[model samples]
Target: MSNEFNDEFVKEIPDHVRQRLDQTYEKIRFQSKKKKKHNIWMRMTAAACCLLIVGIASTSEPVKAAISGIFKFNDSGIEQAVNAGFAEETDQSATNENVRITLDSYFSDYNKIGFSFQLLFEDPTLLSGKVEWISLDVRLKNGDGEYIVEFIPDTKPLYGKSDYSVGVHVMNPIIEQKTGIAQFDTVFDSTEGNFPALSNAVIEVESINVQYANGEFKKIDGEWNLPLNKAAKPFEVVEYVARESDKIKIVKANGNPTSLSLTISIDGEPTETPFAIMKVVDEQGIEYEAGSTNMTVKKGYTLISTTFPISSFVHAEKLQLIVGNEEVELTKTND
Candidate 1:
């Protein structure tokens, strides 16, 4: 079971722990805003930092009514979408080495997929101190047992810093001081057209490796393969007019309950500005956060598809898809 804390629970946490959490949160928000919109490192760092906050905060509970719940995303838009039942809920549990891991929630929109996991320790003292890092050897496959996603951590140093690696798609989990339960989220890389049908998908976690603050390491190896009951709910393709620039044309811009996908056709020569790095803004000039992004070169024009966390556009009368300096007007036909 997980400990539930209220908004006032921060005061109960140790001063040092609270300070560290605040600092880490600030760092994550700053990096997320300053980096490229499609950078995967930002997502990984944000997830780890969020887990750190939750793990440490769960240690001290000031006697509140416990409620069942999972973690939340830092993005307000995505959080709202999740709250509105945009994600698939599940409670599949698997135990190994006295530790229980539960797959609580999952969501996918073809372009991107994300899921949350909760770990409960039988011996709470195992997570009594700051946990430096936790790595899970995770792989995903379709119903036919064909591998779809594999996390291969980079081995070489990234610009003389080995603590973090670049080009790694796995969202590594981080742990801090906690009592028993720790929850975290993971978003896979942009699948583009490579993602197979989501029906009956199986997620296998071969092992989980943990590194503690005191230079201690722990590895829990087991065969944990969980099956999904169905495929992700398909995104509703909102009506829109194709808009084009001298450099590119917006052929497809669709919206789902939690995300927006934009596909653009690059004209003759590639523009100096990369579409994947551009900001995704709505009609109100509000910029949404980017998820997984991929670019492909076709026979004539290059195709770039990037997903943004914009909640939904079903109710909106007028919307805009702004990528860099280019803006595409999207008018909802049924409106």
Candidate 2:
């Protein structure tokens, strides 16, 4: 959590790293903002911010520190992130009394969304030890303002058991333990009832809460919203009939460099395991881990989704979704 690499040390960027940063930064900067603000203020929190800029050119101290945060700051491994998906951060900030939370940068595909945030507790003493538990009240809406996923802890009692007992923690327990200034990475799943790709999603952190083993707790109650362009490729979605029932269908393979996943749809409750990976085979007989299913049940057809840490894959040449020994053709992979 301590940043040994200062901004001064990062002043001299290597030619290769600089080139990669520029390429990624420009593409994201020029992305059509008719949707979301992929605009400015992607400034890094510390010298580690340089990681988002340098693109891992070497084994230097700065590169290692930043890359190590890939998992802490994101749900997927850094090696799995697509180089093209790197976006210039459009930070969204909100302050409540002595607490300030900044939504650093975020990205989304069909079902998975990831974001990084920096929290500054003006009253550092309020936090005494390691953050033993954490959770958020998230509300997501589309362009027409339809509620896509609304889990408000006040009305419902879900997402309330995020315990941080060492191994079961969310963020890097080591880095997140400290008070005052700290950063965290998180992801949200949006595939429900085999719904089509979202046009645009506006998600708001209605509230954030954290707890410690030492009976200490802290929270910031208010809206910390960010708009996301899913970059959804509707035509690229793939379909697979379920092993359990024909009515139950596994839909779409949405992916970027960092994460990949598919959605399952069925009437009533779904019987398929949501966390199991759907093995994929390519044209050259190459194999890749597509996703481990994560799901949510709804009124009509229950839907499921999951993501993998496959960083170097964006789209597949020819792919197949394998559940057990059964194989299904995926005509197009999401980009």
Candidate 3:
């Protein structure tokens, strides 16, 4: 792993890490005027940060736990998703000059989608720490090369030790050697977006703008495409009581065996916001976290779909949902 830390220049952290943290922080800082309707997770975020800093001083274990807590998914989480039938994973590559970009694979559901890529440079030195994206864009195109749905990507660099692991985990970056390639990951919503629904479409890379460490700017552009399809299969949502008036139903389970989750739709009175699902524990005592979730305000109910990844495929059954302020156990039985 690359032990490199940006000790002098603070430019070490890629922008998305800071940007998203700020966005999530500001989001909960001023969520609602009424104390009753206050977001539980957002309210706890600050304390979590404090705990993280304190943990860093005490032990690395707590720091690691705190850092991993930033997102609902991790490497193991991705493995679980793959086991659960992670949609159509397509690979394609494009090259310009000495730089070659390969579209690796992707994960998706009806409401959300995520994909990763490996950028390979013939001359690795050309890639620098100072590089900045002028813009990173992705969109869906048709057979005749027509624009369909434009995905406003939320981007991140997975390979380097950056602020995401540091600020959140408060640890050094997990750097591997400078292999010939660098991994880049990004995700965007499907339903809430203004763009039309993505059905049988090709996911393509529009452009990537970069500013090098030495002040040189480069924009690697391409039309790298991957075939994407909706992969979540609807299941008979088990009606489980979360609160006095609220009920949660496991709606759909994506079929990817390596990576899978039981989708849930929670409905109740207007006062209901949504449950803050902390973890999903199995019969074997393995606890999994919520990976990706989507919610919409319909005429009658707030339809929410949450995907929880168990440790593995065999560990997916006989599960319990750890949700809300009071952790309610929602069960999934083979019967």
lDDT tens digits by residue: candidate 2, 1-335: 21123464233434554353333222211112232211111222111122331111223232113333433433332334524545335456777656666666665444444556666667766554544434445655666666544434333433222211000112422223234555555444332212334566676776666555554555657766666654433233333332443543766555444444555554676454433335556555645553323344566656544444433354455556665545666555233
Q: How many residue pairs clash in model 2?
A: 11
The segments of candidate 3 whose C-alpha lies over 4 angstroms from its true place after superposition are 1-75, 81-91, 105-114, 122-125, 129-136, 140-149, 152-180, 187-201, 211-217, 225-278, 325-335
Q: Report lDDT (CA) for all predictions.
A: 0.53, 0.44, 0.40
**CA lDDT, candidate 1, residue 134:** 55
Q: Please give, for residues 1-335, the per-residue lDDT of candidate 3 as tens digits.
A: 11122244223334544353343233212111232222223211221231111111122232123122211223354444555555344446667656555555555443334555555557645543533322234555544455543433234211211111011112122111243344454443222112233456576666654434355556566655555544333222222222222465545444233234444555543465556455666666766655434344555555544444333345344455666653445444443
Model 1 bad stretches (over 4 Å): 1-55, 59-71, 152-178, 189-196, 230-235, 269-272, 275-277, 298-300, 333-335
Best by lDDT: 1
Tens digits of per-residue lDDT for model 1 on 1-335? 11123354222334554344343233322121232233322333332323333334443441121213433434444555678776787767788878777777787654446777766677878777766545565666667756555542332111221111111122223242444655555655341323445878888777676656665667677877767775666656555555466776877766655556666777543544465445555555666655545455566667666666666633455666666667667766663
Candidate 1 lDDT for residue 148: 54
